[model samples]
Target: MSDPTATGPAVPPLDADVIVVGGGPVGATTALKLARGGMRVIVLEQREATGLEERATTFHPPTLEMLDDLGLAEPLIERGVRADSYQFRDAKLGKIVDLRFDILSGDTRFPFRLQCEQSVMTRMAIAALDEEPLAEYHPNSRVGTIRRIDGHVEVDVQSGPRRGTIRAAHLVGADGMRSTVREQLGIGFHGHTYPERFLVISTQVPLQEELPDIAYVNYIADPVDWHVLMRNPSGWRILFPAPPSWGSDEDVLAPDNVLRQFRRVLPDRDADAIDWVTLYEVHRKVADRLRDGSTYLVGDAAHVNNPMGGMGMNSGVHDGYLLAEILLRGHAGEEVDADLDRWAERRRAVALDFVGKETEGNWSALRDDDEQRRAAQRAAWEALGADDEARHEFLLTSSMLSSLRG
Candidate 1:
């Protein structure tokens, strides 16, 4: 608990129309949007600088639209690789099924997925923030406490050696899974971690012989391990399901271990050229309530999904776009409480219906040891790929275009 009115030598008073906690993609985008809409906005980031992790690389159609609205799509495309199609292979059957994005050319400006590192996306977002004159960015600042006052919310922020208070008409928590703001507001995030972990490895490999011009390739129904290979700007990324008892978080997945696993699944490849490798535990969860009076939650603070469908980051960016619109309307004295609620409802529905379910399905299909189940999974893919309408629907769902409002 922090005293709202206590002004000391260490505590400074800061005021803004909106206070955004977290400097990740969602928070930065929200702050930029709010400030661009004529609101004085402040962004508090706990890290001194943005993280350069290879978290997400695929951006769906709706996300591209959002990026276009933010004037970032062009630059991103300039630095990204376009994935026009995805292939699903059955190792046991020795058969492959491919789905092309061009088939659904009527729905979106970007029918294809963009394969760019998340660090590149963050850089673009930060650049967009720099263009917003009304946005104040405070790096290395952590929000210690946030509370709703009579007409405004007060946030206690600690930046290195300095502690300060920011009073704002509204607040948004986009601080991700372990959201301090969400915890302070007593929001319940209900979810569970997956039984198996995922090992992600990136390297410069030419898949022209086996996978020519293919953007995304998934080796499904493998009894040993499930794998996904995608074309990155500079190289390729290989994602595989790790055994439940692989290693602890503190232990890093060494190059040798990564190569050994690659050899097991993809034996023909040379493993000496590995770039980076990591192990991540997958989780699926969402907060009970995304909003509490003047304070709201966005991004991973609201919901977290497995990366199988690559929906987590894209969904979070969409959260920023929708929440920004609601906040803008609210700031203009419009009735937006219902709209805010609608945003949460719609996003939560999509998360559960599409993101959560798809990831779970992917996990089940990949990890199932039964030969019958693997054959069933392969049959489903082939059947879906062979039918145009079925393939379109599947593409719409997988690309996240079906989840958008008309």
Candidate 2:
């Protein structure tokens, strides 16, 4: 283990109060929060440029509330679609339950899912960071080694031909799942990968015109073919499970195969309507710990669940927000050891217990082949939807308000 307790030379001049090792949504959130809190912050990102890919399109209600607090929600909502309700559907029988976010009106201010690409949030955050004098945003900067010295953290960064060292009071690892900080710190990420890869097809097709009575988001369950369909500002996105039997990547991404999946939703679906396709593996992994000495992990570096309930990115944003709050309190000399401990414990617990199980349950419920279980699942959704109180409670949990509250 890289021990922060190891005796070292005196602390050197600090580059910033906190050094954030990624410039994505989570790192931007952490850096912006700290900079706004009157701490000098630096964000290092290795990407040369941002892509137009539609990654992580669903933002739950509580996540928007948190972003609103950071002054980032409104612009994103303006550029995105608002989904007031989502449906649990059966391929053969049709919609089983239409769960509306309006049921969470009393529980949260933003009682709807914001269907915006994550790039929008990151761009807005980076723009905000650029305006803040206390924050420095560095792109094309890759972080290497991490070392602890005299109660501070030091990191090696490589940007182009320049090699530099930055020392900070603390370091936050929000760099995606393949995080350099986590690897350098020797932290273990424990979990399993799903056998079937997930395939996402982005299309400009107005699916609402073709499908009857479809909401902005729909989870369609079928014994033979389970999939998720959602609408973004661009148009629509469909997710399908790609078993190994699907053949090679080129074969699965073939135009004919893409259209086959679309035709499963609607037989007359046009092949030319599809814009692009992506195939990637999914995993349910959580880091062994959120904090190791003065360095902390947030976002994908800390935990990653399947994007079933759209909880992966939302929960990661929550991590950055909560960690920043705790760190700010500690900086104020408020004796925040307990606060830090509580934050770490609670965040990890949420990842493993709440998000892990919720997403796994979603995937399982959608793909279960047994007729009895399908009937029971449908009845459960009906019972939950029929009762106002029960529906409200269910919406609270699904919208992530209950998770944040607890």
Clashing pairs in 2: none
Local error of candidate 2 at 299, Å?
0.5
Model 2, CA-based lDDT? 0.89
The alpha-carbon deviation from the true structure for residue 320 of candidate 2, after best TM-score superposition, in angstroms, is: 0.5
Write one digit per residue (lDDT tens) for candidate 1, span 146-245: 8776668998887753357779888999999999999999989999987767888887767645555344545455767567787789787788777656
Local error of candidate 1 at 154, Å?
A: 1.1
Spell out the clash pairs found in candidate 1: none
Angstrom error of the Cα, residue 388, model 2: value is 0.9
Best by TM-score: 2
- What is the lDDT for 311 in model 2? 94
- Find the number of clashing residue pairs for candidate 1: 0
